[model samples]
Target chain A: MTTITQGHAAQDHAHDSHGPARGLSRWLFTTNHKDIGTLYLLFALVMLFVGGGMALVIRAELFQPGLQFVNPEFFNQMTTMHALIMVFGMIMPAFVGFANWMIPMMIGAPDMALPRLNNWSFWILPFAGTILLSTLFMDGGGPAAGWTLYPPLVLQSGNSLAFAIFAVHLLGMSSILGAINIIVTVMNMRAPGMTLLKMPMFVWTWLITAYLLILVMPVLAGGVTMLLTDRFFGTSFFQAAGGGDPVLFQHIFWFFGHPEVYIIILPSFGIISQIIPTFSRKPLFGYSSMVYATAGIAFLSCIVWAHHMFTVGMPLAGQMFFMMSTMLIAIPTAVKVFNWTATMWRGSLSFETPMLFAIAFLFLFSIGGFSGVMMAIAPVDFQYHDTYFIVAHFHYVLVPGALFAAIGGAYFWLPKWTGHMYDETLGKIHFWLSAVGVNLTFFPQHFLGLAGMPRRIPDYATQFADWNAVSSVGAFLFGFSQLMFVYIVVKCIRGGKQATAQVWDNPEGLEWTVPSPAPYHTFDEAPLIK
Target chain B: MTTRQDIDPELQRRIRRNALMVGGFALLIFVLYIVAVALKVAG
Candidate 1:
């Protein structure tokens, strides 16, 4: 036994002596969590541009309406591709990137419990994304039935249908594997004194999010796979001609879809939770309650899937159940909003870029949340369903809600990642532009929708024309402003003011204990979390 | 010089076991979904 132990110890020592490998091979083959984290972040960044370019196509076409740029088919393709790429390719992976970089460190684990699985999880994404994007070039332009891929219409989508389904399967598999790794690492690998309750909010949020992923991703896979078979294998799961119900597809899709929204937002909640307290220079107010609120949100997310399908003509009972459950989600979400406010109340607050973004997320996400409550009224939804009002509502949630939190997270941690401070002036400029651009882009759509303009169209009535034009201009400004964010990140990485290990003034976490630009490998020995 | 083997063996076993359980649970849900769909088609 002693001999075997010595041999294992020697192997570990040798492993520790090496740093990252040279060149592209390092990223391609690395099992290091930090390397994988960097790969996920970079990949998400590239996809953001790819996805954003698609948004620009959408906005430019909508600039003056009347099909100014692409055909209607292509316009539908842009909206479809934009949502798929942003949700799966950009936002999900970006949060996963943060998890990879921060989770083990926060919990004081040596590395992910399943390091090889982490590498596989990230590598699967690019190939999956490639398959999905390549569909746009297929004989029939991409999956144009919106990201929902509602059947019958989706069934008619050209050769891209099978490829897109396969891509969804791959994406689902990747998420499941990543989720498993996170659960195992958090459950089994926390440093000795880091009890579950004692974990940082980011780690707790991710733990819950991972469980959400494991539960919901498989359902999406099954739904898409059923779609694949219906298209090619003579199955009629959603084909009305064969007595299969079309509404059933909506049921299945939203069962996965609604939780997927929380999957996207919950991590942002975690990020904001971390930022608000830090800027406030206070221990997180209501830390335990914050954790419970997150769990409450996740639980509520599962029951509220039917809320998205209110227009599908469910029985009044079903609609009432879904509406009430969705409204209940507001209780926990409001608790969170209140906690963040309380954390900042009269504490010597400073508005660094991260805090600025978090503050924007607070007010704007509330706007989104209030709009969501408006839609949750089953009676109100009949009027608002599928209108640009719905469009405005979610963009408020996602752009400022999820996307801003993500950008804020990046700012919060960029100094640690690069060992250099990003240009503060440029970050604030980026923030203002993004804030202004987002409101200008989506806020007008509310007016247009109320005026009876439907979504996913290439042209609009002249009465709706004014808001659409303003929205288009806002989209351009928002699109161009993101370029500055890219520049800020790149500039910080290349060179800037040096950062200390703490990065911020006495932030509370094990991560702050490590050197800035956190070494290639960390926590080889598990930290005792006293 | 700590290698994977240097970590506490019992903890390692627990991690591996729990990971498999989670992975298995996800796969089970996927399989069950497909089975339900198949049953519906047959019916």
Candidate 2:
């Protein structure tokens, strides 16, 4: 076994050998995967606030439900921009950022397979984000048609429409490039003996995610571009009078959209798989099955896009096909959840921040998953469609599901990334606030949806008052608590107790074999794996 | 004393090929968009 002294000494030697490039140009011109990864992550953290700020505006507007702070149009703009920013800007990029940082290290690679392209991918994002955010300040306000960018409604959005489409194109291009980088790195760059099955779960999930991104991102680009032409070029692809079908747009968008949901969460599955085993001090219960389950979910994600369109007047046959396909996803997803629980069962489990968040993810994401199955029932969906319950369902999936894994991942690797220990007490505080705050915010919305409160409205009837108020308070608590998260990240990066090479005791991967704050360049000579 | 600057030629070839393929696929998306616009929808 490698001793702690040896770990610390090796880290010191690495630091002396390869000090980082100095100044802003280092960031601008650097193709080092670690530097680029840091850039992607920092950008995403900033956007989390930018998007979260927009959500707070939305929650505050819905606080009293009587046109309190902003007009209905502006309220619509807030909701629209919020979802676009959070999905395209925050969650998706955050996972990609993690992929960039972790994938090369986890595999025994010196750098990403395409280092220059990796730099290009990270750079495009900030520009795309700028264009999207700039729309809010434009004359007609941001694309108020909602993030779904549904036709006729989105077509009605003024100059902002073109900008939104262009932004989507840029974001899609960035993801596609990042996906290619990941695919090439994993496929070609592994050490000689690190066979496919011997690779880490994180690498496996990302390889699958990269495939999903390449397949679907262009479809989204195509759909949004069609919307652009329909609005600006006098093409009527969505106009009923001009031989265009509005329903056709929905089909195209959701084709990319539903798989887009899995694209975000699949990496989280990898992250959870890694964290659970370490804390449980056990090998993952079913490594091969976990991989198969991910592939199965990706396959199911493709056929089940039509579930989102159940209310759009498809034929009975169409609705039944979609409904059954959607339900089938629960099977593979259950295998994943069961595998995680079994990994934790009766092992030496500890509730450090990462494990706590992972455990929370299992329960809360399941709540989202369960509610999703409820929506899959075509007959019952008619009652629940477009209600706060639908909002509640997805938030449970995204916030605790994707975001929890993201936060846990950061905590899991922060020591390695910064080469220092973060304040454990503060990390726990952030997790509890987020856990309780997220539950408080979305749990009551389920009741409100059942109580017949529709979403995306600026005002509501007096009857839905209590839950809306409770949810708003929770939103503020959740939003502000993230500041604590930012503080923890910054404080750790600056300095703290020096970390050992294996920051955690039992993470079995190439990443832990490297020193904390890994060398600017690593694995020049690949380490041997049995 | 091989430094990080010396990348493998075989790796270089693979990276070049993959980059071109991704570029080609991106071009195909634009082609699909044009087809989407030109094709007349069924009433």
Candidate 3:
């Protein structure tokens, strides 16, 4: 691997061709993958704070005996929009950002396969999100019918519904385009020697995720379009009166939504796969199996959408089949979990911030997954469905699971992205605070849900007060803990200790071969795969 | 990078197969929806 110092000639080369366009046009016209990646990441970070603030409001409203903070209708809107924003606006975009920035580097390509289309895909997001968020302040209310947008109830929702349906179309459109870009880049633009199996885990995960995005995003777009027409254009695509079954709407939505959950979490698995190996000073265990399991899970995702709607009065045999199919996902997911542990077994393990989050992810995510399996049981889901237990289960899965892995990934790759090391003391503090805050926030909701507290209500029955108080306190702590994340990320970007080309001691991959704070355009020259 | 012919033929074939399968599945879903709607009308 050749490392070129930024001599005057390279600096001259850099400034000469890539002329300054001041602020707006640089982001608009430039097709640089890193620039687009930065756009995605920055968008996600801003939206994270937005979503996080919504959670606090939800918690604050639920903190006491009566509706203290907001009305029940407004509270419902917050939960609905919060879920939508975090899933599509924040988590998905962050992972896509990682893909844009790192896939080419890992695969030895200089830029995304369709760079102009990439810019177009990203630029659609802000406008789409604006349209959706705008619904909150308009007449009746936002799409308060929950993120699922189950028909009948969703049908009677406020005037904001059409805007949300269109907004979802725009979001899904962006995702599909972004996924296609990743797919083409992976398939067509790898360096000379990097084979499919030999590509980095992050690239592999994004490859599968891109496939998931393409297949299901259009299904989602079609479903919402039907909803739009059903509501306004006098079509009966989802209305029973028009010969459209409500259950069929579910079938279409879950066909999209179930895979959408995987869309949220798959890249986290890839991040953990990469980080576990690097921090443990071991090659990823069952690397081949990891790839197979990821693909296996993706394949299974399409078949298991019906599991989410187990209560819709399908045939008993159908229920049994969906229940069993959902359970089958456990096999591949367990493979990933066990492999991460095996990779960490007795190697030169150090508790860096990244590794700390990875370890927390294993325990917390597994707890969430175990509960998830319980929820998969048709009878058990009858008890737990639409309860705070369900909320606890997914927040656990998403917060520590996907979101923690994201922070870990950000910490792990920070040195590579910036030419400096973040403060270890601060990083570790942020991780610990986040872990504590995560547990504080999510654990009590389990009791509330199991105690028969239903979700989305601004006011709870008196029986639910104690656990609700505990949960509220946890929410406040969790919200504040994220401020530390914002600080550390900013501090690192400004300046810190100069990082080595290989930031971690045992890290392996093409990314380490580049200089720290990877050059503006990387993977330009293909490295011969050893 | 050299053209696809220069690399392993097996890998290229596998790539082509994966692409075809994914594309075929998408097309199948598209066709299934059309059939479902048609059946709803005719039945």
Candidate 4:
């Protein structure tokens, strides 16, 4: 390894171009994986605040439950655009950012296999986001058909539908390109002797995630194209009045949508898989099993899209098949949960900020999962569908599940990325406040949903007043606590205690083999595998 | 300090071409949608 480093340094100095490019062009045209990753992370952070502000408006309006804030149309736009922005602009890109930064280093590659493509993939996001956001100021306001963008309803969604459709196309293109880059990088760029089984869990999870993105994003593109034609080209693919079935649209959407949920979370699963072993001081208990389980979950994801549409009046046999397939996802998911627990069993454990979030993710995500299983039963879904209960279930999964893991992963890697250890006290405070805020925000919605408060509505009867107020208070707290997160990140980036080459002593991956803050060029002369 | 030649040019060229193709496909989707909308307005 030392010889490899020395050789690379000699070669690097020969050309006098080992460092990142200077100024704006560095971000605009350069293909350095680390720089591109930084751009992605910063972009996601901005979008987080942008999307979070819309959520604040939403919770504020729902607080008193009589349309006290924005009008219902604007409220619907907020809901629709908020989901679109968070799912596409914030969560997906953030994970891709993590991939860009971490995957090459983990696999001992100097850069992404396709650096120019990497650059192109990232640059598309901001443009897509801009188009999506600009629709709000347009004459008819933004797409207000909910992020699902169902036909007829979406067809009536003012002029903003075209912008929304185009935005989705661009976003999908960005994701597919990014996925291709990841697939090619992992397959073709790993250092000699770093075989598939030897790769980090994060890399494995991302490989599966990229495949999921590739498989489902196109379905979305196709489904939305059909909707576009129906709206503008007089096609009746999804219009019941013109011999087309609206339910067919739901079928197409969820086929893409269900896997889309996993596409968001599987990377979080990978992050947690990486963090648990580090904090617990154990090799991941079921590495091979975890890999197989992730693959199984991905396969199951494609089959169970109809579980989301149990209320759409499918035949009894169709309902039964979807319900059972949905429930079967629990097996692989549980295998993962049990494996994490077993990895932690009787290990020398310490509650660092990242570990704390990972543990919270385990408990809360499982709660979400159990609720999902409950909803998977076609009979029970009749009661829960389109209700606040459904809202509670997904928020539990996304907020504490994927979002928490993302934060935790950021904390875990901050030292390596910035060459500075974050403020431990501040990190813990951020974690605790976020945990409390999240519970307060989403927990009561379960009761509200069971009590028949439908989702996507701005106002509800007074019967739902108390819990709504409680949830609103929680949303405010959660929203405010994230400011502390942004502050922590900025403060760390500006300056902190200089981190060591190996940030966490116990973790065994190629990333730690490089210097803290890494280098402009890493693994240029590949290290021997063993 | 590795020079430009140290990088894989063939791979880079392939990625650049493929990326443009994907970007073009996305552009095609946008064009098709705009045409459909325009046709609706015109007809």
Candidate 5:
């Protein structure tokens, strides 16, 4: 066995060649970061489709209402699994995949500081996904306690709940390992002259994100473990019968969930930071402020978790404190929005797919953010809480926010990946369709939510039917728009114009400095960077 | 070897390319978004 030795082995892996893996062993035992990153991404894509399929079922059931397509119980399972699979199985892992592939390259490091752990961290995922997916077919079906796994309700879930718990444990362990790997790599493995300040913003955002993961994910693991114990071993971590408050579970859960929000968006921020500067033909405006704003958002995120639980009967002081803190987040977030716009101001600009999505992100995600601030008010939340408004708010942030960034990053880098330019016409078609479909899907929901359509219900009232129909049509259009993306991406991979060494007309990063398709190994020995 | 004067010609080219491309794309995306809002719905 090759010793999973320390140091630049990871860099060696991160910078692996575009050529075929000649032997089976290269597929199995290799410690190359890029190979592993590729594996993570492919796995996430499969998981995304799987997760997206579950959502389709949820939507189908809600299509006309009256619980026509599914039993209420199965509907609950769909909601839970849809959320779980997407978050754990797809989105978070996808970002980590990008990190593994890009971080070392961005930092000019050879690879992750600890390459072997990186392997193990990614390796654990498929098995974990298998375990969770397997629960769906089991006798009692998968856990129906929602992704939150609230007590008493969670207590009533089936033997499949055990599988869900184990699956979550596996996922938590993987995330922790990945986060630890990131923390150490960023701290220890930067190129010789690369200081913390000199590091890319994506790296900076991820550094903070990694710290959040390490701090908060353990609480998630601990909470879920207690649920396991509460089921089998008679612990009262969440059981009121054992004199434990179930509400305390929300505390532990949101501690993770809140940072988890930043965890999702921070990388997207890094992506925007990268895209904005390159596309704007200028240095990023207020670079230091952008960093501070990210840190500010992260800091504000920790205190605002209570806003989610405002209706749970906290004291007035507690309620007001959470209220103010949640609203305060907008200040930093607005600072970021302004910085992005300012970077684009008066600059000669063109719109490629990446910039297309990034610009959309600022507008749509801010709308979501504004709604989130609306929800932060205890009284207002009592009205909008668990309504379609919440649905609109989150999908706005996640769809146009996180998912857009991922797509944008992919398009931005596609030329480099395949050494061929994707068809711009088809790309614009895909972009237009998605941009239209997404807004149509979520925009009407604000009205439905205001009119009192509760979330997670399989059916709705007659009044909601019109909006719901509109939403479903939008959903189908949005789903169809993605097929174009797949078509464009797959076609580009097969054949296109030979990309120049620098794919973008104004590319500045180190990745573009290499050949069109980067050599299997980049910077094998430390380059003498002037 | 480490001096700023030793910056690679390739480096300057990449920077220029990144500048124009990033800027150009930014404008296009914004216009696309604006056109999106106005195109079908505009009376």
Candidate 6:
């Protein structure tokens, strides 16, 4: 790979004719990858705050368990909307933002293969998000059926259900289009010497993730469309009165849903892989094995969907099959964790803010993974299913696991994106508050779940009050700490110390070969990787 | 430095072909899902 050098001055001058167009049209109509990436990141940030606010409402109501803030119905709406917004609106788009910004650059291409399609993919999100959020003000309020949108209970929702379903269809379209773009770009656009194996981990994971999306997103769209028909068109796809089976809905939803977990996390594994090697100042351990492990995890994810519905009742042999399949996922997941840990072993480790978050992810995501394994047992999940333990498990995975890696990736790349260094001192402060606040908020929920305090309730038994209160306090601390992150990002973008071309020491990839704050149009001429 | 035109024509054709195939497959999955669900409900 080419080393970072200050040779882009002449190229920058040559590309001035193709610099960003003036004003709003630059963002609206242009297909430049960097501009589109900025749009995705900014949109995800807004959704993060919007979703985080709903979470605070949930916590405040559960602070003492007597419906302190909102009615039970509205509280259910909050829970439902929170998961939907976080999963669909925030996390997925943020990774797409990363893919948009880095993939073309890493592979030494000018832009996504389908640039207009890229534009369309991003433009769809805001409208979809607006339709979703607008449901809160509808006559009967937003979708209260949880993000899963299981039938029967979901069918009981009012007019907002149709609007919510429409919004989901739009969101799925955006993902499908976006995934197609990534797959095409990665398959087609690599530089002359950049073989598939030599491509960065981020690109490889996303390639796998893009395939997973293409496969499962259509299933989700179909499932929700069935929900729509059942409610409106008098179809009984999930309604028992018309001889339809509700359990079938669970089977369909979790088919998309389980892989959806891997969908959210596989790119996070990619991000951590990139960050750990850079900070540790060593080549990634077992590079080929890591690739195989990711593919293994993706394949296993498709088969293990039934594990989520063990409590719904299946034959014993069926239960055993799902249980064993779910357990098998642990092998590949363990390989990734082992590879990350082995990457850091006896290396020149430093705790910069990004590295700090990566380390925290390694520790905390494992906690979530272990909880996942515990629940994988068909018998044990009967007790744990739909409890706060399930909540704790996913929150640990998403919040610290996926979310932390995104933050670490942002910090790692912010300098390259903005051409200015973020305030390191403040970044550290953000990390510690977040690290402490996330743990304090989530750890006790494990106890609450084990203690039989169910999830999605407005009120609970008196015995569960203490941990609930503690978890609430931690929630606010974590929520407010994110504002510091926003501040640091804005501060960096506005300007600080001007960064060198290689912002971090000896980070590998074609992205670093370009100038800092990479030019509006990069690699109009592809670089030979070797 | 190789511009888009400078790249091999055969490679570009392959890229176009692959993209069409992938996009078609996604559309097929979506339509197939609706069909399968419809058949199940009808039965």
User: Interface root mean square deviation of every model, in Å?
Assistant: 2.9, 3.1, 5.0, 6.3, 16.4, 2.2
Candidate 4: list runs displaced more than 4 Å: A1-16, B1-43
- What does candidate 5's lDDT look like per residue over A78-113, in tens digits? 999999998898888888988887787776655675
For model 6, the superposed segments whose C-alpha errors exceed 4 Å read A1-13, B1-13
Model 5 ranges with Cα > 4 A deviation: A1-20, A528-530, B1-43
lDDT of 2 by residue, A304-406 (tens): 9988878999999999999999999999999999999999999898899999999999999999999999999999899999999999999999999999999
For this target, which candidate reaches the highest TM-score against the unseen true structure? 6
lDDT of 3 by residue, A216-290 (tens): 887777677777777888877778887777787789889989888889889999899889888899888888899
DockQ of every predicted complex: 0.54, 0.43, 0.14, 0.10, 0.01, 0.58
lDDT-better candidate, 4 vs 5? 4
Worst-scoring 10-residue span by lDDT in model 2 chain A: A1-10
- TM-score, chain A only, candidate 3, equals 0.96
**Residue-level lDDT tens digits of model 6 in A270-328:** 99998998899888999989999999999999999999898887999999999899999
Per-residue lDDT for A288 in model 2?
Answer: 90
- Tally clashing residue pairs in candidate 4: 3
TM-scores for the candidates: 0.96, 0.96, 0.92, 0.93, 0.88, 0.97
True contacts kept of 4: 0.00
User: How many residue pairs clash in all the candidates, one count each?
Assistant: 1, 0, 0, 3, 29, 0
- Candidate 6 chain A: 10-residue stretch with minimal lDDT: A1-10
| Model 4, position A350: C-alpha lDDT score | 89
Output the TM-score of candidate 6: 0.97
What lDDT is reached at residue B34 by model 5?
Answer: 32
lDDT tens per residue, model 1, A1-530? 00001111111233467888999999989988888988999999999999999998988888785778799999999999999999999999999999999998787777899999999999999999999999989997789999999988999988789998898899888889999999999998877667899898989899999999999898888889889989999888989998777787888888889999999999999999889988999988898898999999999999989888888889999999999999999999999999999999999899999999999999999999999999999999999999999999999999999999999999999998999999999999999999999999999989988888999998887788788889989999998999999999999999999999889987888777777888776666655555
